[model samples]
Target chain A: MGDTFRDEELLADVICRLIGDVRHVAVGAQSPIPATAALLAQARGGGSPYVSLLGSRAHTFFTDGARELFDCAGQGRVDVFFLSGGQIDSEGNINLVSVGDYAHPKARFPGSFGSAYLYYVVPKVILFRTEHSRRTLVPKVDFVSAPGGSPGNVYRSGGPIGLVTNRCLFDFDRARRRFRLASVHPGHGVAEVIDNTGFDFDRPTHVPVTPAPSAETLALLRTTVAPMLAEVYPEFVKRVFNVPAPSP
Target chain B: MPLIAQSLDEALAPIAGGRLLAVPRESSGVAMAATRALIRRGIKRLHLVTLPTSSLQADLLIGAGCIETLETSAVSLGEFGPAPRFVAAILSGAIKMRDATCPALHAQLQAAEKGVPFMPLRGLLGSDVLAHRPDWKTIDNPFGNNDPIVLLPALTPDVALFHAPMADRAGNVFIGTQRELVVMAHAAQRTIVTVEKIHDGDLLRDPRLAAGTLAGFYVEAIAVSPRGAWPLPLPDHYGIDAAHMAEYARLAATPEGFAQYLDRYVYEKRAA
Candidate 1:
């Protein structure tokens, strides 16, 4: 929001809408935004039945005895899963592990956690990326950690369904399992979205601009949440949000 | 006690036979030393919990084939013998991956630690991946009459092991981050702990640092080795020895190789 609703509002709106009436979600390691979103949802009265968290980094608050966020994938217990990727294939598969080979590679990307089991097991796979660049939206993934569409003309389920980037939000056609253009965040256009993706897909008449964040939501997030996180992870305040550390 | 050798072979003398060993990735002194012992003992199956430093050590073990990795997500792919590091060596069929934030996973693990069966999540339905996965079966909602419900199976582990920055001789562990470690301890049947230095009243001083998910009775054994969890955890008293880790990673390739490496380092090099 350049001048409109604040960034926090936007985040809150996206999450509130995403977690509608579903129960049980499986989350992985290296997840901060998703965790924040889920915690925010619970804080805001959208109570989820259970949660499953991944990632092995142990901290007092980060790793304190949390488990059973979901049943298995199908039980409707685990519906929402969040992850980020270094590369995304046209078919919606993500690659975070490596670039060229296993032993030695050009650049070593983060590997997929539960991408094999949970991606195959969980119900809904939601992807979040910071920026939508061609480097990110690729024609083909260097490695297919999780298969999206089967070979030619094969029907499939349980693959990536949605991708939410800083620029736009997209959903795939269940049949062909190809990305069909959806809404682009406000002030952004279909052109910007297209320029970011590596491959071509069906074009919508016009992509809707994402709604601006509300004012009330912004105050709570900035006044409360940001301050708390900053106290613990000052670096997060500086890097991820690009804001200077406030008085703590 | 056969001279009470400090070698892993001698230290890990008590536990009965179980293939899969689960532990957190953080650099807890006890688990770290025990993992070192396990590596030295040639324990084959290893399931790791999330720790900031576990990924690096997990890679070292994977490269060595000392443990068959149960779960893995690559953060940075480094070089291994001919193969690239962080590659998903196990290429199974694809599944619908639930995208969760790090914090969310922590909460879920908490729920598991508490022994509650399931929790409901909002906002992930209608995802392409969620619609897939073989285990998920659809059933018509009895109340709604037509709408379908997505059902999931339960996931449980054999063991949960973790490292604590500090612990007592009686096995009270202390931690800084209240991550999902408590949940992991509760979720598993038996837990093994390793610590950096055992003090008399540290955990009791700050009970908040302990994962109350399970009482002290749940812990099977506690090992107190300073700098036990290196790299992942650089306890205030100690720091990570990068050269030692690099050499250790290189040497810990096989049971025989580890034995030879141990003979040089743990066995003949130093007397416990």
Candidate 2:
């Protein structure tokens, strides 16, 4: 486990564990990490589900779960959706629209493809970020691109159930409706999670390790997802996950 | 040959066979009303552009006839299977699939909008799609012996129906960019424009707003409807009606249920 817990590895570990042992999970397009994780889990024979999303149709995965996004509310099949944040409010509201104004936006972030509907509708939503700091963790989202926390809690008015950063895994408390430090990736600690947050949280004494993929999972991830990414996003895959042999 | 302006019965007068008519996804207000009016007049064929989120406005479109066709890409279905009629079309080979993943299809549409005869694109090189879809073909570079470029012939429709924010008496209109209405305008032989309100000016207001986007010269008849693409989505107007769309999901899930819903909303109802 000493491959220097890279960002892609961290994402894969967090996503695989998040799904636990479900048979089906759907993601969106433009999400590279989650796409890899689902493929990795399925390929590794870890009792994990297939990762079906846009563009990953019949080509990437053994089975396609792309249809889950459209009927997320009506059919209710998808287990997770990956999202990002430009601005987030205290109530778990997110805004991917613009940092400044709606009409004449300053930084007009790509408007949510289906993030708004998916965030509110999907049963399980995950907010992921590479950097974990006060700047990234805002007091509130300027736009409600996707809900991190919705009223009535998930299942009724659903929002993000989990957040995974390079540092740790964060899960919102169902009753209190505030993000509580759930676990940290291996080699990381509670202090790291707390230091990165903008808001206060009831810090757990021992923030557990966001589990890593088993040896079998590692092999499958390398073989299945790596090959798929190499086939599809060849350049991005090499640049992001390029891990040279560890120096002495 | 009647020039029906802002009227459903007038626009769809030719195709009142209760078959579905293809329309863009983001139409609203008067455009939606006119579509509804056409449905009431017994034009059953309704083809909606399916996106990821539900095209809730399609509920109104459903009432038009029997929702005989639902044409869209894989991304549009979200979680469920393809719409029933669309599925039937695929199996029966009546409605040809333009596999959205194929860049050739987009280029073809783009070429049509640009008033071109054909368009060249990539990604269909190693695929078996072109061979199956007789409409598409891959030809050698007429210039040199380098490589082949896949081409999609321009697709010109019989009529293009669009909902705009405003239009004048002459049918010159302005549609905010949300719907990509310009593509619809160019790809059709005849264009039907529905306006929310008829402004006094030429409807462009200023050349700055015009931007060569909406070509009034392309439009055929101008219809006026207040809420054409209702409960669906608009450019700068409103978001989709999730609740209404959910009801449609319920209706669309089953064959009998969808037909019954159509009867209550479309068949028995009088023109608005």
Candidate 3:
């Protein structure tokens, strides 16, 4: 693989791999990268995995409205879902609500959407945060929109499987309630990740660099996935893939 | 009796200051034009509910001080960024917030649609959203030992409001594939709709359109407001106005800027 792909492409490639061979992948709003990955995965798998972009009419199949997504997840229909947060702790707890006190937050993020429920139902929840820094990877999230792990008695079929950031990927251990350094993205190192991280995590002594997207994968992303993504994330596609915005 | 209103203001007349108003998510045809009208009217103390989630509609209402309390899953501007006005209001504690998850809000309204006292839902265990909502109670599954589930009280809003592509003279709204509006209409005491145009024939008269049409019986009022979901997409009919939305996100970032936005768009209404 050459150094031709952009960071967004790299992140999308990583998320596609994280998505694995799933039956249904639901990408939420404000998530261009995950939506790209889901489309890419769908294209690559000969359309085996159904991709549902929440806000797109062309991408989604549901006619039952917004509740259908959650209802389907509850019935164990959705296999992979993506969630991002304002802050994510080592324990995989995500905070999409606020950064400070519940009553008077210093910085209030968009209120929690489906994470509270989808995080519990979707079997593979891949956490993605484009920004990798101490502020974002906090020691403890100010609010837990959804816990990374529930108690033994809780009826949880899904939780965080791994986290993909701009710098690296961290695989979550649900039973141990911790994260292990999986692999660092190209141009980033363990030292850089450690320096920027606020919470502690276990990392292998020899952390390999994340592989870049294959030329074939890049071609598929640019030619196929880029057009499909334009339906939902036109601006992102215009910026990352240089796809021209359709005439209004 | 004719249910059509002569004007947007008259259509929104039933939406009193303190009444609970239910609205659909952005993709389901948000009543952006009506929202501006509400702001222009200086409607106050509205308890706004977003069926699953919201974006510009909620932010604009919150910024205009029309909202007293907001009950929703999330409020964002999609690709544009975090809703500046909504974030500021939350940080300042200007309006009461009842933070809820997407499914919970849907279930609450579904309970009302079914005329049930409450609806039992899975998930939301060990979440702060559930913790903060004391009104939401957890009861053990009597059918199973040691299994507890959360029961959400039925949420019957005073009015349900939205925009759509078309409605018939008889008040039958053609909501297309956006079925959430149906749930919202079914749960609310009265349904108010704004459409791009009035269809020639009854929406229910067409077999192809009947499945997606909300019966005229549920709709209390209808107003013709072309491009009613402006800046936001109305699915099928129009795409989002990217430049306008980007401009809105930039201009609405500050209080003075937001006021400027209100002056240019809300106060001085654009000629439809």
Candidate 4:
């Protein structure tokens, strides 16, 4: 993987840019792309933003157990966090519970972990879903594990800043409670996104293609970030980066 | 003195049928040995409360028909894929599911530890999780103007169970950085533990060991079962058995396969 980058790498680069210059970034379990992005951000920022990868001994700073992550988020120490859903609506509502009815239904995803709370507390909660289609980006979510926007009376410090998918990138306007098409990824166009999307979104006359990862970023990811990621996500690194698993 | 049981069954005697049993997350020491014993004994109607989330442990119990109610943040097999049993149970309405976010579970347990009726949490203002949970309430912040926050009722389980690296004869358990065990012990009516080994010396007497030690006062019983958290990691002690987990995910996909798995791994007594 010399000059060219995989879709995962491109997604990671985009998420890393979304992470920006935060004080701390927390990546949850089963999120290899977001984890890669956080690590990349840390490498680029010279370790300014503390990266906490849950279930990794080396990456996390919290010694107070699983609860510490939530407590730290509550205190406003965590700046960036990632959340995904089985179904996401145009308004930014995410559903992680079930597909059809609450009592009885069709498909059922894993229950919400910390999205109900973390989506409200973490300053920049980036919504990410690898699958971008009518099935995932629905007109309305069956259940709101966490809402994209809350009323004024509710205490909310943070919410979805934007949503990134394999097809395109969309920026969420909190006040307007809608998503605007930012740009389509390489080899993808505005019509493809609109055709696949379940809900309507605003797009300019000319939507640019998402930028690919730079050579410097790809080099850093392959050399430095790949090794660090192997600690938590061995299989992902092995498959994506072609790095062999170390002998136990 | 710690009530050191001779066998895993006796160590789990207090966790009777229909009792509320609280367990820790996967990375934290999971009492897999004891869980198997419970299944072998045909334990039923247990209201299982995962401190925050769980994986294979919960899946096995649910598949075995041991759980009547499950209160947890989420249950997944991590990299292995979706927890097949858990998903099936929810879709079939096999058990009562009380969906909660991660922090809400922690706050409720903290409330019980402090002997409070309820604890105020920041989120869950508009989610369906709050709507489904009739017990949880939203209250205006008396301290602030027009501020509303969710209140979670204190959750005190009948017993808290887990596995640890070691425990002293005096019953003090060394949990290292897994401080959530301490919280579970504080909130539960009784705490039962299985250890890989029993240290000869008193755990609380040593300054180095004392900080990470859960005093015998909270631990009701202890049993020695090496590799008690097998298939799951014991943090510093061992890494997860990925191959075994993948096998389990494949085998536990259907009811017949799950029963077959139980017969092979759970019911049989294999040498460690």
| Candidate that would win on TM-score | 3
Task: Write candidate 4's Cα lDDT for B1-272 as tens digits.
Answer: 66999998888889999999999999899999899999988999999999899999999999999999999999999888899999999999999999999999999999999999999999898999999999999888989999988889999999999999999888999998899999999999999999999999988888988889999999999999999999888888888887888899999998989888998998886524
The better candidate by lDDT, 1 or 2, is: 2
Q: Report the Cα lDDT for candidate 1.
A: 0.51
Q: Scored by Cα lDDT, where does model 3 land?
A: 0.92
Q: Each prediction's interface RMSD?
A: 10.0, 22.4, 0.9, 1.2
Candidate 3 lDDT over residue span B1-272, tens digit each: 33798899989999889999999998899999999988888899999999888999999999999999999989999989989999999988999999999999999999999999999888899899999999999999888888888999999999999999999998999998898899999999999999999999988988899999999999999999999999898899888899988999999999999999899988986525
Per-residue lDDT of A1-248 in model 3, one digit per residue for the tens? 55488999999999999999879999887889999999999999998699899999999999988889999999999999999999999899999999878998899888889999999999999999999999999999999999999888788999999999999999999989899999999899899999999999998989988999999999999999998888788899999999977654
* Residue runs of model 4 more than 4 Å from their true location after superposition: A246-248, B270-272
Give a tens-digit lDDT track for model 1, residues A18-107. Answer: 655566555555555555555455545534534444432312222422333323443444667776677887787777555665334455
Q: Write down the worst ten-residue block by lDDT for model 3 chain A.
A: A239-248
Better of 3 and 4 by DockQ: 3
Reference-based TM-score, model 3: 0.98
- Sorted by DockQ (best first), the order is 3, 4, 1, 2
* Tens digit of per-residue lDDT, candidate 2, span A1-248: 43444568668867766766665676664566777776666665544565564443243342212222344433456566677665554456555444554433444333345554456555677777767788767776544554554333123444577777778877766456677778887777777667767776665776667776566566556655676654333334666665321111
Q: For residues B159-268, what per-residue lDDT tens digits would candidate 2 score against the true structure? A: 66667677665566766433345665666667777666676765565775565336568777775666555544444555445455556667765667777766765567
Question: What Cα-based lDDT does every candidate model obtain?
Answer: 0.51, 0.54, 0.92, 0.92
Please report the candidate that would top DockQ against the real structure.
Answer: 3
Clashes of 2: 38
DockQ of each: 0.14, 0.03, 0.83, 0.79
Give the lDDT of residue B69 in candidate 2: 50
DockQ measured for candidate 1: 0.14
C-alpha RMSD for every candidate? 9.5, 20.4, 1.0, 1.3
